[model samples]
Target: MALLNQDSDENPTPGPPRTTEAQYVASRSALWSGVSALFTDGRGRVVLEDVDYRPARLLPGGAIDAGEAPSLAVAREVREELGLTRTFSRALAVDWVPPGAPGYPQGFPGEVIYVFDGGILAEGDFARIRLPEREVTGVRCVEPALLPHHMGPGNARRALAALHARINGTGPAVLEDGRSISPTCLDDLEVLRTPRKPQLWPWHTGPAPDELQVRQSWGWLFSEDGRGLVLIGQDTGSACLPGGTVEPADHDDPARTLRREAWEEAQVRISDPLYLGYLHDDTGSQPCARVRYAAAITDWEPPSLDEATGQTYTRLLATPEQAAQLFDWDSQAAPQLAAVRAAREELGLPAPVRQQLTELPSHRPIQSPAVR
Candidate 1:
């Protein structure tokens, strides 16, 4: 039997009293609900179904029956929808939604979407599949990169955004125009479109005034062995520490941002970051804010690039002495080196050997006569 096959009109014994907007507008009380595996192939593509030709596509899964467990509901739904018997490894996330949200046509007061990490066991998983054509008109696997293109209005879009964020481990939902929608309190929703650009040094100017660019700075402290400190060099010819600017959607302790950035940029895992002082610099016109930390390398590895960017690099650690020398000679490496050294010494490491680079004035003359 299909999970959650009952109709709304049935009004099966009411569980909890239907919550109102006033109760949950600023409250933490949330309904307990469950959704099935936004099942992805090895390539991480999720299965989507078009319902009754609705503009919005949906991941297959449904609410848990009274007294039924969330994980059990997930497994049952997967079997009924995709004809696959699977097991749940763990619950990934419990999505909380507000009451009376106008997104779902079913008039669901709210939902607590529990995502389960699951896997199929047998080749017969694809056999004997029967889709309820009235409810599920069409089905296909949608690559995460293309989800936004197929997403419809309301809860469907929100679910896609949340799932995408969970899968990619990156910022607010990235839209087709490259715009991003960050999670926010309802009061702050109005400012979602306003771009917050990072302050940069005058020499670092390139993005237009209206373009949204955020500045992020972090320390990349490494020991002599290439194992302790991790760094990745981008094709843009800029050497940056592993972290980036903080976003509003980050829920972990702010310090986690340091570790998160390190993993993303250099694919190295950082733990126990010692708090360091913050730095402020201006690229002539733009202001940049940097939060520094001294961290121990609990684990390290080579970096991987997301599909959005094709550039790649290896992670390497260098001694303080070597770092100072290398940074002194390379223009791009100089500033990052200084920052890392300062952080290391603050954490009681040996004072880094210092090498100085002489600043040179620009040689190109302004307003030169054009050659015919």
Candidate 2:
């Protein structure tokens, strides 16, 4: 046979071609990652750092350096930016961003983000912060619902989701483009999307004076856990407790009105309502009282249309503090605290803490209940 070259076999080995390590790495796409910390003021407000380079503020953190762990990267950034030494173990959320996002220049690779909980900061912790001379210009503590006014949309979404994740305590929220891939009922309902209307009206404990007309009935309805129920108006986007205007069928009894309205709006049956107090509504031409009650949920029926709104209201559960914050009642903290205390005592529960709003799951839809 004719002499064949040593390397001239008719068929090459059927396998992928081998390459140098450098060549292999170069063949794959490259991406970067960033880390952030969600620090709260223990009063339901998030800590945001104002940066000189960026128009919008951000949570305390920065990019991961080459060959650095996500946790280490955040710790380094916190030390460099805030002059504080802290370690983070809890991951609240992880978000994946694609390239070409707003503010990201062309040719920049996409990035992954890890958000960690910094725990609630006290007054002393605030005193310890030392901002860098050039990079950071200021710092602010803002309510979660107001984050959009201070941050870019994506950053706000990420931060809000992270806050919810921290409160959920179930696990980290997996996200894409700052939105949860699998969202909770609260997230699905977009609770707190609208800022609560601030009310500075005085709160009165015990029954209203006979002269003051009882115009409305509302409650701090509670679940087995220490969470209170909040109803988001389908038309107005405003949040309020599950109660409504006193109707004739209610027979001038605010408690009866509250029980009926609660069932109609939320399809939730509550125990005998305990009188909490009332809010003096003198904003309009006529002065009247908006009665408030505290009750524990006994049963949850299937979702149904709220006859008053002609739609199903978005029902969410939040801690007493979270409810107060959502109600914009922080300024009148005493009354909010009082209501919570009375409610807990009535239910034989412990003190409530700040937590993420959660969904009150309902089964299949049912026909709208007849309005009483």
Top-lDDT candidate index = 2
Question: How many clashes in candidate 1?
Answer: 9
Model 1: residue 240 alpha-carbon error in angstroms: 15
Q: List the residue pairs that clash in candidate 1.
A: 198-215, 199-286, 199-287, 200-283, 200-286, 201-283, 202-283, 202-284, 226-317
Q: Write the residue-wise lDDT of candidate 2 on 1-372 in tens digits.
A: 122234665764556654556666677878879999999875668899999998999999999988999999999998889888999999999998878788777887889999998987878888898989989887789877889999988899999888767756658999998999999755676656776566666788888999989999888888877788887766554678889899898899999998998889899988998888888878989899987888888888766888667877778887766666455554465665677677778787556555557668775345698999
Best by TM-score: 2
List RMSD in Å for every model shown.
20.9, 7.4
Quote the lDDT for 285 in model 1: 75
Worst lDDT window (10 residues) for model 2?
A: 1-10
